[model samples]
Target: MIYVEGGSFDMGYQRGRDGADNDDVKNAKPLHKVTLHSFYIGKFQVTQEQYYAVMDKDSNSHFKGDRLPVETISWEEAKVFIERINQKTGKKFRLPTEAE
Candidate 1:
């Protein structure tokens, strides 16, 4: 895990036609500011072996490799995995929000 010293910053783009063609980018208008609190996040994505160590099951990634990042898991499944891991390790862990 890596410690992130959080702070505030402006988020989103200005509301105007300035070559942002994508709907997603256009919608990111009305620029806003956001603040975040310091937190810890994994330095690397969870690998197949790491997931298996905690969940006691194969991730079933198409390209199977113990060192590869686990894939094909739903949000709920990830939450359950985190819950189980926290129980086993006695540490609080959660997925980062969109802003984070």
Candidate 2:
């Protein structure tokens, strides 16, 4: 049950091309910034062990153990898992939309 504290962060390419012209989506970007408060996050990606523990069934994830981050999940399904985690821990669990 590792928890990750959240914070505001910038999300964008570290460098823009020298000739990056205007109207380019590269520049068409809005504030690629995400502002969220402190919340718990998985120290590792959701794992088969944890998923089975919470959902009472294996995702049949190929990772084979708790050490691997369970991937191949849809965005909506991930949200559902997060919601369940929040209920169990009494703290919010979510994904990051930015880079620190």
Candidate with best TM-score: 1
Instruction: Give me candidate 2's TM-score against the actual structure.
Output: 0.57
**Candidate 2 on 11-41: residue-level lDDT in tens?**
5443453345544446544446776666554
Clash pairs of candidate 1? none
Model 1 has how many clashing residue pairs? 0
Instruction: Give me the runs in candidate 1 sitting further than 4 Å from their true place.
Output: 26-29
Enumerate residue pairs that collide in model 2. Answer: 4-41
Error of model 1, residue 18, in angstroms: 6.8
Error of 2 at 2 (Å): 8.1
Overlapping backbone residue pairs in candidate 2 total: 1
